[model samples]
Target chain A: MNAQAADKTVATMAQTRPLVAMDHVSKIFSNGTLALQDMSLTVRGGEFLSLLGPSGCGKSTALRIIAGLGGVSSGSIDWPSSRINSKGLPEGDISFVFQEPTLMPWQTVFGNVFLPLRLRGVSKKAAEEPIMEALTAVGLGDFAKAYPRELSGGMKMRVSIARAMVTKPRLLLMDEPFAALDEITRQKLNDDVLNLWRRTGITVIFVTHSVFESAYLSNRIVVMKARPGRVHADFPLVTASERDALYRSSEDYRQACEKVSAMLLEAMGDAPEGH
Target chain B: MTSSVPEMNASSERRKDIALRIAVPLVMVVGLVLIWHFGVVMSGVPPYILPSPGAVLSALIGDWSLLFPALVVTTKITLMSLALALIGGAGFAIFLVQSRWIEIAFYPIAVILQVTPIVAISPLILIYAPTTQVALLICAFLVAFFPILSNMVQGLKSVDHNLLNLFDLYGASRWQTLIYLKIPAAQPYFMTGLRIGGGLALIAAVVAEFAAGSAGASSGLAFRLLESQFRMNIPRLFAALLMLSALGVTIFAATSFISWLALHRWHESNLKREN
Candidate 1:
């Protein structure tokens, strides 16, 4: 993790094509509410991106659209650097984490983590290593036999994260996954997510309303607006090579948070007069 | 080391709590039996009118040879109907959840069947069915079917939207989603249905037997009760009534145990609370 190697990685990342592109996507509910309006965004490979906005900003809508869980009303989504399945969606290359830890109540931690692989026709015997690897990644290796009810809120969320990552998807979409957790658990999960993103080099599109969270974890932030939800501003927020407790207290991180807060205020139409 | 004393005290307290749970019910049953025997003795009512507890017990032993076969027959009918209801109810629920149109088309018919009293319709079933056993089974099946169907339908429909989106993101096929996500998600509701349906099936079977009034060796306990009443064998009637109640309790306890076994690990409803 020297400067020269980091510089080389950045150079190559910039040169590579975007993994997915949302071009003029609009989402209108049948009841006449427009969730997203002509929204356009590009997700480059190996980037930690955050969709930061207040409620009704369609950040979650955008994430769902990208994940193919939702359809755009008028525009198209394209994957330039990832493989597509027969249904024109990405083939086992996307995972999503929800605000709630939505584990199967009937399944153990190991079984829950092994779900994606099992759905792909892998036998339980074949999934053992990868399942354990995922549990170990989330530091839940010993609790594989435990049920979700046996875990605390934070531990359940960890199991959720392990399930999401077990498939080794190229893109991970999280919609306020830590919103329900306490402050300490939230911070711990935030660091774990950032570390996982860096170690795996996967593209992350996290949806959140917290300015501090967006600023701390994301290399790039897309600030969105409500009403007819659309991107108000998109900017880079790279503050340091390594983000940890040290980075959180650094002057650079404070400045980054302030900058993102200003953009969020502007997006919410509450920014003060310009300097 | 100092904490060991409190831990031991807590364990002993828990043991005492368990003992109380078991002892209280036993005391209640024994006390009630004693009261019943004394009440019969003191009142000096004829055995045909009010059998003593001892008389009932002697009748149970005396009639075991005749009544055991009838018990087996009734048990068979109850269990068979319950099994059929489970398979049919869950299968129909899965079908209905596949599309709104199917549910809309058929749910009303199911509602009508459920709302109409089984006793009111038992005569028609007896006329239509090829055999007395089939008629009894149909009655029991009808009684047991609705709870399972409704609960399972609600459970299948209650799957978390985010988990559905995750499955879509993983490119899971419809069959895979049904097996891996929907079925597991609906299990708690299905178990609830099983408990309700199990009790209902037994009741319906006995009712159907009474309605049929069949009196051959193949007849169930309901027929024996009728025969005992006609012959003024009050103690034997009480014995049959006691056997029926025992069977009902056994079915209830078995279903509850099964539900606990399935859901104690993960489901909130079945999980043990420390406090």
Candidate 2:
């Protein structure tokens, strides 16, 4: 049902503003693993999209390819008005948060968050306010002095989020960031990330294996399949864009989740088992 | 914020844990010394072969004036070589990591040097070097270099691929990534190498002195060991051996202290936990 709506909206999105476009991109490892195959995606400007799939479906590989972390063996990707830099990154700045917290464990919370700007040659003195602001955004204003080892898992993930946001990039990529957190912490972070996206209007490409999470957070959901990884279903999430606690219980959200779950099951060549 | 009762308890528990850590090690050392003393007294080994603990202690005190200068000389050489190895090893490792060709082409040479016994090459090194001091320095450097190089290479390569993706997203240059991500991430591994290298450097220094002592003009502790042995000054020989052991212990402790200082804030190696 949602696929028809997505097909219609996708055309309008492509016409008005396409922030990034992947054209039949494929990636194969030297060990002969086909992580991605003939995958094409169009990420519209300022959209919250999630690539939802099972473990080996290459959602992460797709995200990495888009962020220029991994190279495509065939086909190409294009960004609006700018080509890739010599380093394979888009000319515009990008930020990525990995599955694990991946904070420099030896660095303090403030130092970890300050890294992107520091990498761009900003001194600590000059970066102090921005670093504090990033930490504060994640509600860790007083915990800047803490080390990663001293932090709880949720807090460390927050630090990772702050580090990704420090650069104020045009694009942000996050791979299974909240998967390790408990339900309550994950919900809190989900709301916080939505708030950040609303405030910054940065384009986001999120990857996750959670059906409910993708249905709740994303405007569009890309369901992918494994073996030779490729997109199985691309559809508009029918739930409201300004989602909240109410949306989680609303009939639309339930339907969207069921729809995504069914798509995923079909993608994996399995009969859908009711949740 | 008000300190909770549980928080106060946690802090006190941590303090107690640290005290126990120190106290346990201190007690063990004293116990071992007592056992050594009693065993030697019971065995009645001749002083020339195995001096009694008291006699060795007395020799240490009586010969302090002579032994102190030799200790200082060996220490200077060990420290100098260690510093040189750290700089050269890390620099070359970074260079190797910059290109696959460079790493593949040169890594074998490092392995060859590491496998070739330093004792076997010392004579050749002495002949080529301009002086005895230079030859000793070279020997120490060769022994210490491989750990820093190989461990650092392993460290540089072991970086989380996701973190590398994060760097790439931010368009961090090779140099920027090295300083910001790779170098900081490599700390634990580098510290491991440093601890091993520290002990190896001292061993190499003493061994080099032994090889170089053939010139008979050496003033190092190893040369002193030789002179005392030749004269059958048993107590002094025991004193020299004690001094050498003391030096090794000191270097090990110093390096461990450095690793602690560098990583206690974040790495698991230095963490103090309640449990």
Candidate 3:
């Protein structure tokens, strides 16, 4: 009876497929540049997935396509029946955190954070709590009244993240969101983003060039290659959901980083030693 | 001691900078007036041809009642025309950003208005309008509108692409994106347009008054200047010229203050860099 119960659990786990799937998608810009050709990806619901590759790999293009900001020239992206998927939900529930802070320089932190909800026609009074909550989540609660120019580069990035989170999105797309920040600030933000994802049970698809960052933050990494960009490889890290400073400093994390670096080099067609 | 030395150097440098900015201008003005006063006195140049500084000052004080009313008329015309141009320019700019085709269609017309000298257009306005004051206002409006329109359009277009994509992905409506994102982003450019437009409005007001030709004492300072010239009242002509110059300076100062108020908290153009 115990064996049969375990079998049943495996069947149910198999039934819970990826929330989103892109089937051989292609994107060709008007300038005749093929940014992506026959790229396929699957994003599992409530997982932290990172797309890691070289500069021309179209990882950002793929993320933008997933966000519906860019159009695919061919093939399709499908979503299963997960609640976090795009099925029967308005696109407003999806959020994107861009590379640069991209904060409205004219607005204070509270105003920037308040934007998404305000765009949805939520009254200022109704959005005040959520805005403040998001700011607090990013440790920018004290900066609500500060303008973007008053904030440091890291603080600006925090405000941008706060703005994205204010709407409580189901799927969060981050495209090298912390690439410009210093190492310390980047690590802190990485920790904060993971906590946010875990606490909210939100799905994330992050795009970055850093192998170490991908290994450290994501459960799965999707590696891509240039010259008509397409998915090159996929690797899963440890199955554990929790990661801490001890985990980051462990042999397991180092191995994962090494594996990702190997995958990246291989994806680049075994390019000669220089980064 | 090291920190204090740098701080002391900075304060002293700032004081020297202030002295240069103020004292240089003051000395030049005093020296130029002294030269003009002595040149006229020593050369025995007739007051009817080139009034002495003493003559100009006395003329300004004695004819204060006449000049003051004319100054008020000129200022009113300039300010009213500026108000009209701002409203019209901003409204047109908002319309233009609604579509690329709209911008292409109407932008050249605005450019043509800008390039065609107001001096050439003033006569047509004088002939068409019911009164000289209305004609002057119209001429000023034509002069002021294009800078505001062109700058606002450029500002709207210069919005960060990623920010725009974020707005789009979040399902922000066209109206919401325009009001929250585009308008605020366009502010720096709008401020630039205002500065240019302020000076142009004053010039147009004066030029239009010249074109209006003997439209009476209430026709503005330019008309008073012309009347004084015809009557060989050189001192009064100098006084009118001084009032006109003062008006231009005042308009520029007011526009700059407005720009500072609007942007000092956030914009790079106004904010003082720490380093």
Best by TM-score: 1
Better of 1 and 3 by DockQ: 1
Task: List the candidates ranked by DockQ, beginning with the highest.
Answer: 1, 3, 2
Worst 10 residues of 2 chain A by lDDT: A1-10
Q: Using alpha carbons, what is the TM-score of model 3? A: 0.90
CAPRI classification of candidate 3: medium
Error of 2 at B268 (Å): 1.4
Question: Rounded to one decimal, what is candidate 3's iRMSD?
Answer: 3.8
The lDDT for every candidate, in the order shown, is 0.90, 0.84, 0.85
- Looking at model 1, give its docking quality level: medium
Quote the true-contact fraction of every model: 0.84, 0.81, 0.91
What tens-digit string does per-residue lDDT give for candidate 2 at B53-103? 788889889989888888888888898999999998888999999999998
Clashing pairs in 3: none
**Residue pairs in collision within model 2:** none
